[model samples]
Target: MAPEMISIHGGVFRMGSDRFYPEEGPVHEVAVEPFELDATPVTVAQFAAFVDATGYVTTAERP
Candidate 1:
């Protein structure tokens, strides 16, 4: 069986950080328009299928 897609509602989400990572400084606000996102996070099984078809190897596999 294949994974299902997910739908996300339109809303304003706070982005960035006030005091987290150096690059994350200067907090900012973002507007995420209504859109459908993947219901489940990509799993190893799905990645494996993609690799099997494309022979794709990740950086970790490069040593």
Candidate 2:
């Protein structure tokens, strides 16, 4: 069975921080597009099954 998913609405929101590291400074507004997210994190066994069935290759498996 496929995993459950959550639909997110698109919107603008504040991102980052100005009080922390220099790179994290300059808080600004960010626009987000609608997207779907898995309801829960995938388990190792589930991921392994998916890879076996689809022959999916993870980045870590590549040099």
Candidate 3:
């Protein structure tokens, strides 16, 4: 079975931080559109199963 996804309503909000990193600063206003997101986070075992089925190799696996 596939995982469920939830719809997120879009809105305007202040983004970024001005105190932490110099590149992240200047908190600016941004608008976002509705989007769908996974209802739950992926589990390590699920990822392992995907890798096994697809023979996928992560960057960490490479030298």
The Cα local distance difference test for each model comes to 0.84, 0.92, 0.95
Error (Å) of candidate 1 at residue 25 is 1.6
- Flag regions of model 1 displaced more than 4 Å: 1-3, 43-63
lDDT of 2 by residue, 19-57 (tens): 878898689999999999999998899889889999999
lDDT of 3 by residue, 9-36 (tens): 9999999998899999789999999999
Q: What TM-score do all the candidates reach, one by one?
A: 0.52, 0.66, 0.58
lDDT of 1 by residue, 1-63 (tens): 766778788999788897778898777889988887677798889889899999998998897
Model 2 clash count equals 0
Model 2 segments more than 4 A misplaced: 45-63
RMSD of each: 4.4, 2.9, 4.1
Q: Say which prediction, candidate 1 or candidate 3, comes out ahead on lDDT.
A: 3
Ranking by TM-score: 2, 3, 1
